[model samples]
Target: MTDFPFLGILTLLPLVGAIVVALIPRRNGELAKTIAFVWSLAVLVLTIVMWVAFKVGGDRFQFHESYAWIPSWDARFTFAADGIALVMLMLIAVLTPVVILASWHDVESSPDGAKRSVPTYFALLLAFEFTMIGVFAAADVFLFYAFFEVMLIPMYFIIGSFGGPRRQYAAVKFFLYSLVGGLFMLASVIGLWVVGGHTFDFAKLVESVNSIDQNTARWLFLGFFVAFAVKAPFFPFHTWLPDAGGAAPAGAAALLVGVMDKVGTFGILRYCLPLFPEASRWFAPAALVLAVIGIIYAALLAVGQNDLKRLVSYTSIAHFGFIGIGIFAFTTQAGTGAVLYMVNHGLATGLLFIVVGMYVARRKSSLVSDFGGAGKLTPVLAGVLLFAGLASLALPGTAPFVSEFLVLIGTFSVHKAYAVIATAGIILAAAYALWLVQRTTQGTLNPALEEIPAMRKDITLREKVVVAPLILLLILLGFYPKPVIDVINPAVQATMQDVGKTDPGPTSVVANGGAR
Candidate 1:
């Protein structure tokens, strides 16, 4: 472990930036925005350096740093990065700047249609980024819980204060669902202390908790599982996603779905399985069933949606189901694919939200019916939207395709039935994505929209700049994911070993009846 507190600095830099932005006079909105963007970019640069320095195939938690916060309770402000956390941290760092640029003109307005204070808006974004980094980097269980709960506050305000017309309802709903989940997790956190000695350090908990009886461990696991499932918003608990996504500002929605919800899956991989291995295995079947159902059901719902933002949100729910399947499958390849899926999903869905936001900005509506022949008016924007949509559907030559393929291949090795059923989501994904393009860009121009000056214009240079990096990443990762896969595979293998599982041997045979 290094003595340098790189992880702590990475976690706090955004918070410090938020403070500075907040202190800036509200009258200087542009200055505040500039400062916040620069700070977020600096955070990205630091994260890139951290990535370069990370020692792959070494200690599970690199750049470890710890300082006792409550000695009696064994609580500490500890932080580190494994391959999974590093990937998520990179996602947060990359998306924060892209979101900042995407929201350059996404001003909040009063009921009378006057623009409100933009400084507070950007400040909240920075604060949200702070909690996001903390959640991924925290090594102590209590620290993780604190960051987890604190993250909801900024997102709640972002949605309720700056979102669409039903912002309050959506925000409150999002808050309540998340609060209930967090409360369930709090109970589990307390239970861990009581059952596994009073240590809140994740490493200590994992070392000590094996003595817990099966029934007790299962209950504890359920407590954490419910919270994660709700956050994952799997199946029955997923009603909040569409409402929240549809109502939030595009940047906020992107982070909400793209980066923040990932904590749920990350928690399951990081805390749930290692700490409650037997219980995780015991519940695997039930979890897999829900994951499959979510995959099929959400995809069907997405196909029926006419609202563009809500459609995109539904697609996310379905994709998360694929991630859930990968995680629970207990194969190293599946686990690596799940983690990779988190990164790719962020890029593809973030681009989709950005493109949709551009359309909404021009048309002032997200209804699919409100658009027509937009491809003719803005060919570059249309092409980007099509590419993003292809990525969302896991088309060949896209980042998602590689990840999704690995997930299915890995799952098929263990549970062929589940893998087969989950594949339906891909076809449904194609349906919804192509339908979106057809309705919004292929038909004759909507007469109502044709009269609008903004609707007639092409994508702006700023929008192109904001989207270009994500496009490049999707293509780059699609072709050469070895760099990420190499880092991920070792961590995933370790996780599977901890869970007492291993991938089954390939069963296919050659024509001569020899193993291939």
Candidate 2:
């Protein structure tokens, strides 16, 4: 919408930073980390500036820039941000610095990290930062797709090179699954270009979709839907998440789930619905079914998880289910809530993953059985984990609570049966979250832990620095979600209009409680 090229510079900054990081002397690992953190902080500050400059009521998509990249294919280096994309970009900014700080000691602390290439790890983090920004900020479909596939590579290297015992296996599976999804997305992109007058401009494609038949639209929609569904990791596609989340270093996992996985839901909201409205409606029933199944299934899996990291991973699948309900419900309240949930999930689950990592780092294990009565030794750590669990379960006064409530009530009006089934996941959520808390923090101390002095030490100042902001945001958002909701409302309205659906009207009842 502007000639400012704000987004182009913004997107390019991190790639420049990545190259700078890669240039840092390999022996100066500490310097590499310091520079990476400093660079991320700079990006964060610029993001704040960008957020301040974003006139919410101005153009529907602001700070847009476009330059022809492939004139024949009609693709361009297009980038812009609506309210939804803006918030996600802000989230990427906020979390990147935190992940960098959290990974400060990652290489030095791990047993398998002897092979961890310090410069490579930090460089990849910076490079990954580049990809995350590009994916969310991209306006051209082909551009988005290119960023989409590029984002996966850095993460694959990060996990395989710097992750856990099963790093190679986890990395490969994650890559192949996502790679297959990318191919489907590729097909859809090509299909859109051909049927869409050989153009990949998003606005043009939206208009072009009308020229395509319903049958062809359905096939194209499936290509996109399957791609997102896999990335969203709905049900059967979800098996890779646990393995990857558990195997990656905690900081990386936080970014992986917090921001990267969101690309899936983001793709659904930004691309799928508007491009193929009929297909979206036709698929809503099945998507809702998958959402409910994912909610219940993933929650149950979390409850049975013995590995703390994997348990946290399962919890995300369940949360995504709630997000799916909100998005598919086709109401402003639910859609706005889904966006809010995405932000809160990043905060709450990101915190949970970090805290779990802290525990694992000290105790040298992630098993629930490896910890008991830990509160007595490290009350601060115990308390943080408990707070994180409470937030995860959508405790009445937390950020997730507000979003989850919106999602449920919104879905209830439209799909009562699915809403009820999804609500049950909350109970299952409580069981897993609280049970994980109690088993790890309360009761008799693990006999083996008493022998390890590291287990007795509480969270250090650096760790506190990492967690406090997220905790503060969770509580603040719970009490007042208006800021985010305001930005999200118009975008959701646009999407609703594009989908040709309106929020269900309220039933009229007379003063005497009679239906009118």
Candidate 3:
């Protein structure tokens, strides 16, 4: 077995960095920023090394590490990475540094009228990174849940403390929603422990769950599913997302709506499906139906949005609805597409928030109307926004295009009507996306905006540094995604095997071929 200590070190690195950064003197803002950057970069390098060493060929969890943390309850400080987790780990690694740089200009030593320490904000942001990585890497269910729940503490502070005017309301609302959902998931986790012979090991739990009574399994599954659905912010459970998104600082919002939301869908794929196959199958259609409804309903809502950030948030909800349906569709293409969509959405959405934050910094507004004729004022910023928007709407040459196409093709195979409904979301996406671009970037210059300052100094060098990799990948992945799809296919195959059937069909081949 590969050394577990290395895994432990990887997990703890960011947390340690956070603590160190927090302790840095307040007057040493430059020092604090430098430390944070170095810490984030160090963690990224460590994660990359871990990735290089990770054995993707085997379907079993790799980089296995465990330590007794709660013997009575059978909990352990366990962590590992499967292909799915590995992808998430990589995404986290890439995004952390980018986000740090994105916030470099904004998270100042003293940003005039800011309450409760700028240093604290950076520290909390760093801490959140640690938890996010832990959630993706944890091999033990309880450990996973702990990391997952821990994420909210920092994110709440980030939004409520560092965010906009309604930050307090939005933060409290986000925390409450997440707390209730997490409690439901805790019940499910406890149930899984009891039902699985008091084992907290994820692999063992899955095996034990396969033999449980279907009725009991359904309840357990719902417990987990409801929590994830809320995190995924699906349909009726998604009321808090726009508010949270609108209120959060750009960097925090990127992490929340971009990366954290994936945890929900990931939990469904990793735990819910393989562990509760019968329930998953039994409920797949219902979930698909709800997902379709979310897509259509949220897309319609997006069209009417005046707030740019909120509108983008609604679009994410719509995109996630597609992801939910894709996962539950139980087709390889759909599942793989969903996985790719997770990463693609993170990059695209994070870029969207970053760009909008810059625009707001200059224009002093998030309203779509306030942004009229920005293309004339800031050509480069407008161009970047257009690029980010195209990726959002799944333009054929962009990242979302391939993933969404695969999702639809996969879903259509299993449920035609649901696919058709979800397809309409594409039309709505196009409308809102193009309309947003036109109103913000293509129209005549609004006289009021002329006095607002020239597009935040035309996207700083640091900003360019932050977004460059994401943009390059968006272009690269749109045409080629074999690296990710290759890793995902084996895992998806393993999952499908556990679910009781296998098919080497058209969609399966395409998914194996990677985002074609």
Candidate 4:
């Protein structure tokens, strides 16, 4: 009931757990697994408590914590949670434990009787959680950049150490892309600090940054935007995502792509728009175009993919395109839809990876052709897969429907032509989604696959536990979006207001549906 800085405690708990797991003797793999699960679960519980305690009616940051860390340089130990941060926090809190469970049996051994299996994996995963939460909770620009940059390490190791054949290549490529972006973001951070009269506190910086020259601000904004876009893996920068997702383990892919990737678009919404309002408006048209192109391009690619995992990866690229469009479009509905899309995409995408992992575990392959008639052989798994796929494709009554509808509605107001073009992506989505289902679940049983018995009778109780919340969330949020929208709308409206007053003539017509 106390209004103390509970959010900071939630953020630190996982870091404590990670340290403990890393220190545990390597031989104690079972012990390490149990401890990691408990720690991740505890963080989840604390997050839920924070969510319940959060004041949704408040129109500003809450649980604010600030301390002077480097006063001479104008930096501070600062953290806070606004509605946007809360949603991202909840996404990370819910998904990390599920991913840990999915990787339960993935403990590996080095040669010479070294027993370093699950401890390393668990430690790195928890470390990633710490950084992910830090990104969302940070109230200081320098702290946010530090967390954002540092997150690359654990992810790099996870993919490189435990991924498929091309693991090394994928890991290196992912790291290089992220590192280059991070460096650029650092430059932007420094520029912002300087522009804001040497203050790194995000709220103060936002207030003082108004006087920055338009040209310099635009470049600085792009520096930050590029880093997030690379993370989001937007369009051309997205080449790394498929390779990374294709090569990584299912649990790693789920967290990396599902929750981590959202940080990119989230950054655009949280920082780029608010801090550089003029730049955002100035660049909106171009950003919208790229988003539309990415939507169609990635969807088409998904349709052509033979690898189930790769196809899902491509599908995410398309989903992100919609999110990016929504952010740059800058309408209240579009912005709120973008936030909801992040949550929905995380759940739906996470579920997809979990099901795909199960299938891969049995078939020893991720190829679509290798999975024929799986529905007949395993009804429960097939049913969950079907549900997951439908939810992903935005089936009505599922989570993504409302978000997608909002994005389209929001975009129609400002970018009607692009929205019309982007509508085709929905049709393309149906094609690829249905194709994935048919290829794996509906066809006649393959002779090679038929010889192998279904390893699992149905989704494991654990599997059901993992998916049920997400499925429930998808359904609940799709219909009862008000709870989320209420918190999100005020934030989005405030951001839009920061970008400058909205004109009811062309701007409103284009952004809200009047012109369209």
Clashing pairs in 2: none
Candidate 4 lDDT over residue span 183-213, tens digit each: 8899999888778888888888788667999
Among residues 3 or more apart in sequence or in different chains, the pairs in candidate 4 whose N, CA or C atoms overlap within 3 Å are 413-510, 413-511, 413-513, 414-510, 414-511
Q: Which stretches of candidate 1 lie over 4 Å from their true place?
A: 108-112, 508-516
Per-residue lDDT of 134-233 in model 2, one digit per residue for the tens?
9999999999999999999999998988888888999999999999999998998898888889888888888877888999888899999888988877
Task: Give the alpha-carbon lDDT of every model.
Answer: 0.92, 0.90, 0.85, 0.85
**Model 3 misplacement above 4 A:** 1-6, 109-112, 454-456, 504-516
Could you give candidate 3's per-residue lDDT for residues 336-385 as a string of tens digits? 89988998999899888888878876776788977788888788888999
Tens digit per residue, CA lDDT, model 1, 65-119: 9987989989899998899999899999999999999999887574349677788
* Candidates ranked, most accurate by lDDT first: 1, 2, 4, 3
RMSD of each: 1.5, 1.4, 3.8, 3.1
C-alpha TM-score for every candidate: 0.98, 0.98, 0.95, 0.95
lDDT of 3 at 271: 87
